[model samples]
Target: MKIELAENYGFCFGVKRAIKIAEDNQNAATYGPLIHNSKEIARLEKDFKVGLTDDYKIFKAGDKAIVRTHGIQKQELQELKDKGVNVVDATCPYVTKPQEIAQEMSEKGYSVVIFGDDEHPEIKGVKSYATHGALVVTSPEELEGVKLHEKIALIAQTTRKVEDYMKVANYLIPRYKEVRVFNTICNATFENQDAVRKLSKKADIMLIIGGKNSSNTKQLFKISQENCQNSYHIEDEKDLDFSWFDNKNLCGISAGASTPDWIIQNVIDNIKSKIS
Candidate 1:
């Protein structure tokens, strides 16, 4: 069997930069997991003694605190600073754009609509910036009965699928008088998803490597599964079942933006070993 990797997979600029920020600030404590990968968090904890905590109340003065790439609520960050915690912001620039847009739109008297999961950390952070608070919608149907202002602003979580966001925008544009759409999806996310869509045509089986909780990884897995029924989302080699690859002549590999090259390599090596 031939093994091929996706055109764009593994760590993106934001994730690589976030990991570097954690490494540079040894003995620091991130406000949350710096990124979504558990193995990478464990590596940081073991190698640099960087701890992870989601609560701002527990952090003390003179201690270092790194903001997650998904960012945090504005009030929570302010509270951390007020407590004299040395803050090292590792928020991805892509995630910050939507927050700024949400705040500005709300300030201008426009009702804001975010196309993403309400419970996601990024969405929570972005919603806090909206002056009038924003409506979170995962689909166009979610917007059906919600009352809206004449002027409306639309944005999406950095990792959500482009098509899904567009679906909501398409539904709103016709109904709303003035609609402003910001393509807030990260460039890396677009590339990864596009690459998976391309890989779906050539491979018999697909392995998507990333943490189960990773949104971007889940998107890739979903995109792949839609086109190829033999797709599997696995965190690492341990999750791989040999039977999935049985009689498969070609296998494709893809990883989320948060996934490190080492994990991808290990999974690739393991898959190749089983092939023979």
Candidate 2:
């Protein structure tokens, strides 16, 4: 019986910074959910006076607000500042890079086309920074009705799969005269997927630990499932069904970008407890 683990797994730099910011500013009422993971959010809620607001209007003077790792638009941030809220910006540098790129490209008269989930907060933030019209696309199939402008720029969500972004870029490159593609996918995500793909080859079953709503975590699950049919995505130890591992001895564990190291350690400990 062997338990394999992905070489690069758990919290990425962005998630780490966001969590730390939320934790350190416990004296003030923290505004907005820190991360997508419910478990982590719950832990913060228990420790600090966290404010759950759908809009930034709830923020007041002397209140502490956490700029999530995904980030917010400049205007929204300015509004927060004007309202006299103390903002702890935890935006991931990789995610922030795309916003700056979008701003620069848009200023240069390039119609920006971002390859990412439109509903994602990160994408929304990136789009808001575009001085020119910004379009979001989740797949190459969505390129059918896209109209070309003279100058075009393409960037991807930081957690997006590299192959998916490349495919989208390849599809758009033929139609536009001037197309600039920035492979904005984070290095951590790339390395994590590579590790999962490699681990899948040897493990009998794969256990992915992360929130289901997390984009990067979902990507990891998708990639692992493709390679190993027995792969399972679970948020924590409670979701683990030991029956699945009854006949399996060699299991692999991997987590999403939003998953904290403590959660991953807990899952590992639980699994070991059951096996022992």
Candidate 3:
């Protein structure tokens, strides 16, 4: 069997930027996982001595704290700064756009509507920027029967599928007098999703790589599964099941924005060895 990789898989600009920031601040602790990939985080900890802290209060005055790429709630960030922690913002520019939009739109008297999982860190951070509170929904169905203001402003999680975001926009545009829709989804997401959609159609087996908790990775897995029944989402080579490769003619591989090339290569190498 032959192995192939998606054209636009692994380590997006934001993840790369965050990694560099973490490397530069060796002794600093990130408030959350710097990125979704645990292996990469481990690599950072082992090599650079960067640490991860779930609680912001652990940092003392003058201690360095690197913000996660997903960002923290606006209040949390302010509190960190107020506590005199040397804060380094590593929030992805793409994620920051929605947070700014939510605040700006909300201040302008537009009801903010975020198309994303409310529980997601990015969404929680973005939603906090809305002065009057924002509505979070995963689908158009969730918006049903909910009362929205006459003027609405909509933004999406950076990693969410555009088609899903559109469904939410379409639902509001018809009902509201003025609906302002911002394309907060990043360019990397567009390219990655398109690449997976194309590759999965041709490969007999598909491996989507990234952290299990990664939203973008989950989206890639969903798209791959839609076209290839043999699609599997794996974090690394260890998760591979050789049984899935039986009689497979060609294996396609794709990784999420948060995934690093090293992990992807390891999975590929393992697959090649097993099938050989």
TM-score of each: 0.98, 0.95, 0.98
**Model 2 lDDT per residue over 154-247, tens place:** 9999999888888888888878888998889999999899999999878889999998888888899999998888999999999988888878
Expressed as tens digits, the lDDT of each residue in 160-256 for candidate 3 is 9999889998989989999999999989999999999999999999999999999999999999999999999999999999999888899999999
Candidates arranged by lDDT, highest first: 3, 1, 2
Off by over 4 Å in 3: none
| Candidate 2, residue 252: lDDT | 95
Better of 1 and 3 by lDDT: 3
Clashes of each: 0, 0, 0
TM-score of 2: 0.95
lDDT score, candidate 1, position 219? 95
Q: TM-score-based ranking, best first?
A: 3, 1, 2
Off by over 4 Å in 2: 29-31, 48-51
Winner by lDDT between candidate 2 and candidate 1: 1
